[model samples]
Target chain A: MDEFSFINSIKQSTYKQSTLLKGVGDDAAVFRQSSKDIVTAVDTFVEGIHFSRKTMDPFHIGNRALAANISDMAAMGASPVFYLVSIVIPSHWTEDELSQIYRGMQSLAKQYKIDLIGGDTVSGNELTISITVIGYAACGKARYRSTAVEGDIVFVTGTLGDSIAGYHILMNPGQFINKNYYYRRHQMPDPRVAFALELEDLQRVALNDISDGIANEAAEIAEASGVSITINYQQIPTSDSFSQFTVNQQRNWPLFGGEDFELLGAVPKRDWPLVQQAAQRTQTMVTEIGYVDIGKELVYLQEENGRKPLNKKGYTHFKQVKL
Target chain B: MDEFSFINSIKQSTYKQSTLLKGVGDDAAVFRQSSKDIVTAVDTFVEGIHFSRKTMDPFHIGNRALAANISDMAAMGASPVFYLVSIVIPSHWTEDELSQIYRGMQSLAKQYKIDLIGGDTVSGNELTISITVIGYAACGKARYRSTAVEGDIVFVTGTLGDSIAGYHILMNPGQFINKNYYYRRHQMPDPRVAFALELEDLQRVALNDISDGIANEAAEIAEASGVSITINYQQIPTSDSFSQFTVNQQRNWPLFGGEDFELLGAVPKRDWPLVQQAAQRTQTMVTEIGYVDIGKELVYLQEENGRKPLNKKGYTHFKQVKL
Candidate 1:
């Protein structure tokens, strides 16, 4: 199909929100903000770097790409309203494959009520999908990563290591039992948008998405907030499938395995009760994994022996380099 | 360099606007809108497709990518405020080369007062830069392509064939005279933002960016507005370099060669004087190229002999296909 026809096909089934003043076919998408502030993020997923044809279906690739951007908005406690996708497809791909990608995106868009505003589609040698998510937050309500106080308690929503374990299962198919569960987690991550909004209502001090694993993201909160973070090894939440792994794998995966798309945040120590109560009300499985302290270390792993420096071994795009 | 460290390096030199509540190192960038509505657009430039390393410098590649998206915003008469860039770089590129790309983007961002907010960086086999621009437009003031009236006069800003001529110069170096002019025009076609705003102030009926050449964009205006358009071939603006070409080259290139980044709009015939006066005040050279009429033909071209159907042969991504 030509560019215009492809755009028309995508436009025919789009769910337009009332806030959208103009959508597809315009030079630009115009929308109104009902709130005081707008939160925006862009994420690009390359075929081989972020996913592969051998392991991931095109539908899951599209789903994960949008989910990653949505997760970023979720960390800000914003309600996602609109998204623009720029996709470069390989020439070899079929029209059905392209439609599957859009269908995957529509599924998530329907759940979040996001309008697919406008984008560009091009043919290239590699498949690359970039999504920009625009969301809204009320005045002074959006969470930040640099607001954690020294005495704040650090918490993470949902279990970590499942995505990484799922990835392992996907790559080494028959080597693991119950591969479906882990593989699903790797392919489809549920962004904690509603849970993060609940935390925002409860007035969390700092927030970030764990796209780069718990240890790296926790260190980011500490570094940005100018505080020290200490994560108790025993307190780290792991999935039931994750528990089937050996001790070393369990310890390393949850701490360093990335792409979890979960929310990691800090709340004042005094407000722990309220935070827990809100999580309980929302049915969000949040675990208190660490605390902030007045020190220089970005993150310290508290084990049975002693507190040691946490290894910054999570995924960074550039190999053998630390951010 | 790792993704985080590269982001930190970029964050250090970024120009943050006062309206930006949060920027790099956050889950999402937060900004405030002084206007009632927001305009957004996304465009991706892929290696070997939109540009090639053999013909264009990396800096020009970056600049052109951002300019393309900015032109979309200019078409809406929106003030470009912020942009998020998601870039996929090959492993072979050096830090200097990557920095040059960022520098190219910074030059345009500085000119437009757009803040570099937040985005993701990843590794890929090919270089792909996708930019999402967010701009503001006053409530009910943004122009739409679907609002042209039957008796509206169509105008285009600056010249149309310059970009395509420049592309030819770049691709076939020694074959063209005044190569610098054409090459620069191709690499950096100035988006008519200020001019479009002036036209918008003058209450222009409809507007669009001429990224896909005069014929296709004019057809878009016609189709979107449900009106017939007639073009006077003599009235179409051509750059000095473009005029130096043969009559056939001039005709075919301007009509069908894409990537002009000029503003195409419709104004009621009665408001022509106001539009001309506004354009003069803004020092923008705009030419009346056509008229919207009460018929079903999307576009008709007037030559010396008689009127003929204008072919929709502008650049579309897929080969040998029409929308």
Candidate 2:
């Protein structure tokens, strides 16, 4: 079938959200304005740079692309309403693979209760997927990195370092002893959208998703909010599978290895209980690993040995090898 | 170098839109909702497929990417508010070339008064640009392709076929005597956004931008609206430079040539005067080209010889060559 025929097939689905006045099949998708503020984020993933057949299948690639953007929305304490995907497909990709990629997104959309409003699908040399996710939050309640203040307790939902371990195991299958749990962390990440929506009940919070790991994300909050942060390395949570990794990896991965898709945020000491209740309501793991302090923009890691400044850095996925 | 700085570098933009609570530094861009309905469109342009360096410079490529999405907004009779550009850069591209591309989009953003929202910039094998433009229109007033009804007067804004002819001139320089006008049309297309905003006063109308040429766009309206459309070939507007081409080229270019960025729409017969007044006020060249009638979904083109059925098709820019 022709390209237009393929794109048109997606819009003819039975699902249509009530808020969307128009979806696909139009020059632009139209939606009625809601009462809440709007949150939008765009993320692009290229085959050679972001994913490869070794680490991810077609479905996994698509799922990861959407998950990355949804994680961004959740970082802002917003619930996704709609998403637009623009994909550049190579001629070598079979139609089944394309359908599988779309099916992967549809599956996540169903879970998030978000509609695929519109997108552009075209031909290209490499598989490139860019997704723009739009979400909504209570008025003036959307979380930001700059919202962190002195005396706020920093926290994270879910165990960290597992996804990075999973990624390594995927790249080198036989090296790791425990694989399935970490592999699932890499293959399927549950973005904390429901948890973020629940956080809207609180008075205030500052959030950043752990896509770039806590070192980078926490530094961002410190820099933006003009505050200092100190995290206790011993208090950082991790799964048993992650703990099985090398000591260096156990320490480094949680701080430097990204793509965990977990929520990293700072809340007032009083609101920590509310956040814990929110996590309980969403049935998500919650842990307090850090606290905000009054100082110049700096992030320090408090280890058993001593306190050390953590550099604002994350692992790069832009590999030199082409897939 | 710290690779995490990509997000910080793009955060350099100092956009001053009041509605924008947060711009680039955050994981998601947050904006206050207005009274109008929101219109959103996403378009992807890939090197070797949608365009090549032969027909466009880096700046022109950037400009065209934003123009295509803005044109989609214009077709919906919406005023652009903000845009997010996700670009995949190849390693071969220099930093200056990348800056030039962004400058291209910045030039147009200045004209359209739209802020650059958050987007992902990553490394890739191809230069793929995916832009999502968000706009707003009067409540329940955004025009649609399916809004056309029986006895509506069909029309188009601005000269047709210029951009495609310009595209040809860019591809085959020195082949055409009239080069600059067409080249400018291809390089710096002024999306009819301002003109579209002026048309909001009208009671009812249907619009589809002529990115895929009038024949394809008209057929889309006919099919979507479940009406028949007939256009007289002699009445279609073309510039003197366009007319200098071969008679066959002149006929085919206006009907089948795409990327003119003109709006082809239908309105009730009584609203023709109102449309003319709006065009006059906006100082945009608009002309009557066709009319809608009750029939099975079909489009007809009238010529000196006879009338012929117009197919729902447009030229594909997916050339089989890598840049």
Candidate 3:
């Protein structure tokens, strides 16, 4: 199919939100923003770099791409209203494969009540999907990574390390048994949007989503907030599926493996109880993994043996080196 | 550089507008919107397809990519507030080359007083730049392609065919003398944002950007508005550089060549004088080349002997065939 026909097919299955005034066919998409502030984030998923065709289905590829961006908005405690997706498809891919990708995106968009408003599709050597999500928040309420204060209690929502463990299982399917739980975690990460909104309403001090590993993201919050963070390695949350792995694998995965798409934030110690109540209201699991203190070093890990500096490293694009 | 350091480098050079509440380091960028409506457009430039590394500089590539999206917003008569760029670079490329590309984008963003808000950079097999521009317009002011009326005068901003001619010159540098003007036009087609805002203020019936050639765009306007548009072949605008080419080349290029990034719209004949006055105020050159009439044929070309059907074909990816 040609570009026009392909776009028409996409439009047929696209979900339109009430805020979208014009979509698809116009020179640009027009939408109305009713909130006091606009929240925007963009993430690009490259085949082979982010996922491999051999390991991932087209549906999962699309779902992961949009989920990555949605997670960013959730990190800011915003409700995503619309999103635009730009896909670069390889020549060998069939039209049916492309439609499947769009269907995958449509499914997630429907769940979030977000309108697929605009995008561009082009031919390229490798498949790459870039998604930009536009969201809304109340004025002065959107969470920021740079707002943590001394004595703030660091908290994380949901379990971690499942994504990386799932990725490994998908990479070597024969090596693991009953990998569906981990695989689904990797393929369809649930962005903590509703939970984050509850946190925002409770007025959290700082927030960030763990796209990178917990170590790297905590370091970011620490550096941005001009404070230091210390986390007890034993206190880190991990799923039952992840715990089934070897001890070393479980430890390394929660600390350094990225793409968890879980929320990490800080709340004043005095407000910790209220924060827990908010999490309960949202039915989100909350774990107190660390605390913020006045110091220069960004992050530290308190293990059973001793305390050590936490290296802020996760996935690096070009170096092809793991830390 | 790793992704963190690479992102830091971009943060140092990025220009932040006053409306931006947060940028870069946060999970998402936050910006305030004062306008009643938001306009968004996205365009992707693939290395070999939209350009070639051997012929075009990284600066021009970045400039062109952002310009394409800006032109889309301009077509809707929106004032661009900010833009996000997602770039996938080949591993063989150096850090300096990527920095140069960002600098190129910065230059244009500065020209329009828009912020480089948020984006993603990943490693891929080919250089691909996808830009999403966010603009704003007063409620009920943004123009649409589906609003043209019978007796509306179809108009085009500036001369056409220059971009394609310039592209030819760039492709074969030694074949043409005085190629700089055309080459620059091809590399950096000015997005008529200011002029389009003026036209919109004058309440033009319809508007479109000529990225897909005037013929195809006019046909789009006609199809969307359910009216017939007719243009005199002899009246088509061509720059002096374009006129230096052969008659057939000039004729065909103006009709079928794409990537002009010019504006095309329709003004009701009664408001034609007012629209021309608005263009004059904006110091924009506009040529009336056609009229919208009550018919179903979409588009027609008026030749010296007789009128003929104007085929709606332009640059279609994957088909390698030029209309």
Candidate 4:
């Protein structure tokens, strides 16, 4: 079928939802909710820039892209209602392969109960995915980073650096012989959507997803909240493979890798017990990695030595791959 | 400065807006609007895919991408409030060039009264610009395209086929020796922002942006509405040069050329007078290109012949570039 016919077929499949006043075939999709609308987030994932075609398959790429934005919605302690997705795939990709990408997206949308209300598809030189997720909350309770006061406990959901190991295995299979851990991390990232929603009324101080590793994200919250962060190295969560590859694996990979897709959140010192209880209720493991301090810096509180300053460089697009 | 520092500097410069509970630095930017909230639109302009690196500057490309999404908000009669722009530029690109691109975006954002809330910068193979424009409307009266009836008259805002002509000249300068209309149309086609806002409360039956040419866009609306449409050849508006290029341009180029970015709307017959008056008041001309018919086909009504069915092929990313 022609592009128009293909688009038409897709449009016909869209089921009407109560919140969505309009869907595809309009300038913007309209929504008709009764209460105060709250938080929204947009994230774009480009093939070569965000993920390598050599390292990631179309399905994982699609899932990760959608997951990245969904994680953002989760971070805000809002229930994701609807989303718009725009895909720009290079002409070289087959329609069947593209359909698989959509299949992956459909899986996540179904899982999260977030309706895929509208989107755009176009041909381009490289594959690019952009998704905007709209989530609703009560008037003023959406979570943010700036609310992290000094003495707030820093917490993270899920293990980090798995994606980093996964990337290494995906990109340089020969160099890193074993494929299991790295591949798993690269393929599937569990966005802490359930945990985020559960903590909606728990008075969590600040929240953010760990897209660009824990250390970089820590620095971000520190800067935004104008508070210092001192991360206790022993408290940082690590997988078995991550621990095994200690010297060669770059222990800081979890602190700097860009595609972990985990959630890093902060809770007031007084509410740490409540935060811990919420994590158990959501059936997700939580790690207390650090604490907010008075000075505006990110410091690594090493077990052997005293505290030291940290750099802001994360997984850089250019440094990882040379043109 | 490094990429992190640059981003931090930009973040530091941002003034806190009370409407935004959280801006940047977190998993997502949170907004706390009074009555209603909506996640808006995002458009990506990648080098070589959306524009020729040789012809279009990064600045214009950035501005245009933002404008495209802003135009979508206007189509829904929503005021653009915030935007997140993620840019991926090659390592070779200077910081000055990057700043210039942001300068273009900043100027337009300021003019539109939109805060450049947050975005990410990364190194990549080619320049990529993606912008998500967040906007809001007062819940009830946002326009949509699924409401068009059989008796509605179709109207289009601004001119068409200019981008195709502009592309022709830009790609092959020798072909179009004279510059005036060709260059301006190629560089910048004004998005009808004000006109769309004026369309509020009109119960605009169906609406779409004419990014793709009118023929293709009309077909989309008709196919979506399950109605037929016929365009009067004499009533179609074109600039002097558009008419001049008819001999050189084929039916495909005029009908299928995308990037017009005008608004194509279907209005009830009774609202036609009001629409025309609104257009006149705004000092912009509105052309009644066609009317909704009973069957499901796009027939171009020609004076010489009773009716000629037109092909619905518009600009396709996969299609071979003609120029």
Number of backbone-clashing residue pairs for each candidate, in the order shown = 2, 1, 0, 1
Q: Mark the 10 consecutive residues where model 2 chain B has the least summed lDDT.
A: B314-323
Q: For model 2, name the residue pairs that clash.
A: B166-B182
Error of 2 at B262 (Å): 0.5
**DockQ per model, Cα:** 0.55, 0.51, 0.54, 0.34
lDDT of 2 at B182: 81
- When sorted by lDDT, best at the front, the candidate numbers are 2, 3, 1, 4
Residue A260 lDDT (model 3): 88
Those runs of model 4 whose alpha carbons end farther than 4 Å from true positions after fitting are A4-17, A33-37, A53-55, A167-182, A240-243, A247-250, A315-323, B8-19, B33-39, B138-140, B169-182, B240-256, B316-323
- Position B113, candidate 4: lDDT: 70
lDDT of 2 by residue, A156-198 (tens): 9999988888888888768676688788788778898889889
Best by lDDT: 2
Per-residue C-alpha lDDT of model 3 across residues B1-323, encoded as one tens digit per residue: 66667776667355557778887778888987755688987888888888876557888888888888899988998989888888888888898898889888988888998887888777788898888899988887888999999999989988888888887777766767568878888888899998887766575558999988888999989988999999988888888656578878878889878788988899889888877887799888889998999999478999999998899776575432111
TM-score of chain A of 3: 0.94
Using lDDT as the yardstick, the better of models 2 and 3 is 2
Question: In model 1, where do residues sit more than 4 Å from their true spots?
Answer: A1-5, A12-16, A175-178, A315-323, B1-5, B12-16, B175-177, B315-323
lDDT of 2 by residue, B63-145 (tens): 98899889999999999889998888887987678778888998898888888887866887888888999998998889999
Better of 3 and 4 by TM-score: 3
Residue B180 displacement in candidate 4 (angstroms):
3.5
